[model samples]
Target: MKHYLLAVQIDETVPEPEDELREQLARTAKVSDEIKAAGAWVFAGGLLPSHASTVVRPGNGTTTMTDGPFAETKEQLGGFWVIQCEDLDEALAWADRCALACARPIEVRPFDDVV
Candidate 1:
């Protein structure tokens, strides 16, 4: 099996009520548990708002840190899951479940491994 990253994209332009946020969190947690039970879960975590992100750029043998995400977009990566899957189809299947559970768009990418 190879590793895949299932990234959850969320729109940050709109704000969610506290109650709705709690409900989605609960639903996502349930999906995480299901993924673990299926032995496909490596790890999963949610991120803070994109504004909390720091971008580091190395130049002239020095690094500068910039606040916010690298790109200006309405949607940002809100969370991600690392799972081991046989192929893209399996990864997409997991992404489908995650998208439904989290009510967000999921981007599936395979990890590079040379052996």
Candidate 2:
């Protein structure tokens, strides 16, 4: 089996309506439960807003710090799930469910097979 990351993306600044956000959260919970029951769930979590981010770069034996995300892309990684699966197809299936539940895009990537 291999581990895959099901990455969820969302806008960093737009505020979602309360009711819609509630529905999305509920749907995500349902999907999480289903994944757990199937024995495919390894771990899952949401992320804080990008404003909470900090960056550090080392130069000339000194470190410089910067606030905010590493890059200025339109979409930010809002959350993710790490799951052990047989192959990419299985991981992708799970990612599909996640995207629907979260009402956002999902990016599926398999970890390097070193096992």
Candidate 3:
């Protein structure tokens, strides 16, 4: 099985109302439960806003740490799910469900094999 990452993208510029946010979370949780039941779930988690992130960069001889996300974009990675699937099609099916549940875009990518 190949491991794929379903990354949830959130547009920070648009604010989600409390009620809508709650409903989205509920729907997302249901999808997560389904993934787990299918024995495809490896891990899943939601993240704080991009502002809460920290970036570390390597320099000539040292690493520099910076507050906030590495990229400056309205659309940021809000959460993700790592799951094992038979192929890209299976992963895409899950991504479709996830995107609808969260009312956001889902970026599906497979993990590279270890050498």
Winning candidate number (TM-score): 3
lDDT of 3 by residue, 1-115 (tens): 9999999999988989999999999999999999999999999999999999999999999999999999888899999999999999999999999999999999999999985
The global C-alpha lDDT for each of the candidates, from Candidate 1 onward, is 0.93, 0.93, 0.96
Model 1 residue 50 CA deviation (Å) reads: 1.0
- Residue pairs in clash, model 2: none
- How many clashing pairs per prediction, in order? 0, 0, 0
Task: For model 3, give the 10-residue run with minimal summed lDDT.
Answer: 69-78
lDDT of 1 by residue, 1-115 (tens): 9999999999999898899889888989998999899999899889999999999999999999999998999889999999998889999998998888888999999999975
Residue 24 lDDT (model 3)? 96
Please report, as a residue range, the 10-residue window in candidate 1 with the lowest summed lDDT.
Answer: 106-115
Query: What's the C-alpha lDDT at position 30 in model 3?
Result: 98
Ranking of candidates on lDDT, top first? 3, 2, 1
After superposing candidate 2 on the true structure, give the runs of residues whose Cα lies further than 4 Å from its correct spot. none
Superposition-based RMSD of candidate 1 using all C-alpha atoms, in angstroms: 1.3
Best by lDDT: 3
User: Model 1 — TM-score against the truth?
Assistant: 0.94
